[model samples]
Target chain A: MKTAALILSAVLAVAACVFLLAPLVVVVLASFSPTPVFDLPTTGASLRWYGRIANLEGFWPALGLSIEVAAVSTALALVVGTLAAIAAVRGALPYADAFAALLVSPLMMPGLVLGIALLQYFRAVGFDAPLAGLLVAHLIVTLPYVARTMIAGLSRFDFTLIDAALTLGCTWRQAIFKVMVPALAPSFLIAGLFAFLASFDNYPVSIFLTDVRTKTLPIKMLQYIEEAPDPTIAAVSSLILLGTIVLLIIADRAVGLSRMAGTSD
Target chain B: MPVTSLSRRTLLKASAALAGTVAMPSIVRAAPKEIVIGGPAGAAKYFNESVFPLLKQKLGVTVLYEGTNSLTNLQKMQADKAAPKFSVVIMDDPVMIRAAAEGLIVPMQASAIPNLGKLVPGAVHLDGMWANYQLPWAGIAYNTKSGAPTSWADMWAPSHKGKVIVPSIQNTEGFWNLLIAAHLETGKPLAEAQYDIDAGFRKLKSLVPSLLNVYTNAPQAMNLLEQGEADMIGGQFSAYTLTRKMDGAPVDLAIPKEGGFAMPSGIAKITGGPASDLADAVIDAFLGPDVQQVLATKAVVTPTNLTTPRPAGYPDPATLFAPDWGFVAKERGKWAERWTTELL
Candidate 1:
């Protein structure tokens, strides 16, 4: 019975991996099609779709905006969320749990609901700035990831290390920088990675917020698909997949994949 | 190369170049020769590739194009009412009517656009507020293997049960379903017919059992037909349906005996834009014979410009049943709500 259960579990795990990764594999293969359609090439593979990605209308500006928004939001969320997590874990404030929940509430809310609310709120306040609005919206999106990860990390953290460092003649600020930060480095990397990715690929929230000139990559890609259902989008998706793989590989080297996933010590 | 070794001529040249740079801004700022326009992404490709160059040659101005949907354009214009970001907006006729009422767009003199005289009758949507550039008809799309539907009401026929798809009322294509349903229930001409909300609802609900799927957009509906998941898709247009057929899909579009709805798209000038003249010129170019032909051939839409010859494989624009735009613009939202709440 035990052996049978193990076999069943292994099969289910393999099936799940295949189900998730099959679409990505198809996309990468479709990107090499000589034709403009989304179907894969039957005759031979071609790189014309990759070449077309460079010339796709408004692609560069959209990519640049997406990167800028994600980088800025991730950096801001890392700093603010880490401080809030520290407060939630250490400060012993009244209703600390509620405060933590409030900070992470945006994650629980549907992106569409958040988008509509933000648009109305922005309109009521008479704020028409697209770039600034996108930054604020993405910060809301990414903050929950950072806060949740850091909160969990801090809970398991031994605060006595900072105390010990202080007693060993480190200044209060020095003790935090020298002791707490290094100890939480893995958590920070994990939090930053998740936050950056969440912000980078955000669509539903960005849709309501994006104006014509300030379109993000996902919106632009959708527009491209609407305009022409072609392999260029597949090519772009393959590139994005490649980039993510490289990023994960780097993260694995630095922090270990198991640690980043919170699956192992 | 030292600062002390700088020649008099070089210093004079540097001073001259700096002066030109300072004066260039004022010269360029006095009469800005560029206009910003917004439209759908696919349609924008046509204007960018075909129309903009001609405008630059003839009108001596550049066009900055933004790809967007009609609803988003209206919302943006309303939000930026104080200072309009888009100089010209291109969208559907119903949206044009709503925008006209909201004062997002301005009425124009026929004299401003010579090509306006060449348009088919009733192509002027809201008098001078906007004009229809394309008159695409919405109807039923069926896979040939499933057999052609003879009438629009045949979508609900017992034979097609569980083999039909319908679009959600929120989509532009879906509006046709409501208009067609009203026509199906009432024998009166579409213009004389009311939305007949109750009767229309009854007719649509009766057909719900036949629906294999409900789609929010034309692409989703067509995808079902292509994949053989559904046999027929209502609230789709011949332009897209025919285009797919050309791409070797087994689908074909039919204007039912009751006739299909005319889903005309229009272009308007932003009311308070700084570049209204350029916008007018662009509109004129869009309505011109050459541009209209290119749009018809490339976009698969029927041109409103009467002088532009029909492209191959296009249906007759005269056969389409056009409803009252004003009524549609006013009641579509309520109908869409009812559609979602009362029906699926």
Candidate 2:
């Protein structure tokens, strides 16, 4: 019975993977297909659409925009989020639970609502239609990831060393930077990765804030797809989706996915 | 440089790009031949039927349909000058005129497609674009349970306060509705539609608190109506046909007394793309008789060519109200800004 159940589970797992991955596979195929629409068997195979992607003017700028936003957001999230986590774990604040909850609030809000709300709020506060607005909006949504990761890293950290540092008369700031930071380096890195992916893939906030010059890849893709639904979208989306997965794989390979997984929780 | 020089760690990334290139359709271009058409996929089907066939028989070229939304297609045409990708763009009139002003489209000789004479008056020669298609109907759509709303004013009846839905005034249709609603509230014709704008804005603002959702797309709201989620909302002339087609739902299009809103879409010639001639061929097909018959059956979308007959179970286009296209074009941006401020 157990063996039968195990076989069933394996089949189910494969089926689920196929269900999730087939559309992506078909899209990858469709992106390269000669025919404009997805239909019956084609003559053989093709690559003109991918070439079209390479040649499209929006391709490079959008990709660069996505990468830059993700990188900046991740780096800042790592630093600020790690510090917050270390401080809370060190028992620096009263009502730390409330503070932690507040830090993670952006994660609970839907991206679309958060984007529009930020747009309206920022406009009312006089920061509308600018790159600074996009950055600030992105920062708010990504801060929670850093803080959440930092919290886990802090919990797993060896506090005795910090206690010794306190006994040794080192400043709290000095101990945090020199001692606490190294112990929680893995968590900080994991948080940074999460923040980068979130910012990189973010469309709602990016689209709202994006003007002519500040447009990101996803926004360009949205604009193009809305104007023209063709095989080019499959090619572009596949490129982005694969880029993200590859980035995740690199992160997992370089630093243990488990440490990040633990920190993620 | 050899692709092998790519970082060993980034091989996966390198392979993906290479694989993408390897899989593209192998259609050879001997002398740079293709017809690049930019329009909604539904709009592009005429390319398959009318234009592509004619292009092959006459010009000896294949066409690529770049099915997309109205706004960005125009932007793409503007950007692609040196080596154009699209030969023709079938899009909304506002974008087409905007492109013409921007000098994105090449001016056409009246000698070509003499069928321009069949188009409605406002659809005639603009700076560089011409109206080849139009949707001369727009007004509030109500839940069948709310009874027929014969005019725009009935949508504001106290009963619909909690259930009322309106399209997002951010889109072109939304601003168009804003202009029409303003005119309807004051009981004016299209020429006098502008005189009573402020009263309409103020009246529209009052319903802000009661709105359930600001819908963006037309078809999506029609779905909500069939589900019985909306008591009243804005819609196209053909909302009734789609609902009736799907399980005999009693949803219907309401032609308001002040005359249903008039909005027309136009086709602009893009300088880029080898397939432009094909795009023209498609436009010719759109004006042809075959597709118009199919279009009529689906919805009450008015075909541009006056020669075509109305579909069975659809209203005659003659009965619907039409506003000044030139005036609407001029006022679109300002009205859009107002809508953003007032409705969004």
Candidate 1 per-residue C-alpha lDDT over B226-260 given as tens digits, one digit per residue, 9 for 90 to 100:
65678899878755676666556668888778777
Q: Cα deviation in Å at residue A87, candidate 2? A: 31
lDDT, model 2, position B87:
70
Question: In model 1, where do residues sit more than 4 Å from their true spots?
Answer: A18-51, A83-105, A120-126, A150-184, A228-232, B1-83, B144-159, B169-172, B175-206, B243-252, B255-261, B330-334, B341-343
lDDT value, residue A129 of candidate 1 = 71
Model 1's number of clashes is: 0
Error of 2 at A126 (Å): 36
Candidate DockQ scores, in order: 0.11, 0.03
| TM-score of every model versus the real structure | 0.79, 0.53
Best by TM-score: 1
Q: Write the per-residue lDDT of candidate 1 for residues A215-237, one digit (tens) a residue.
A: 88999888777665557889999
TM-score of 1: 0.79
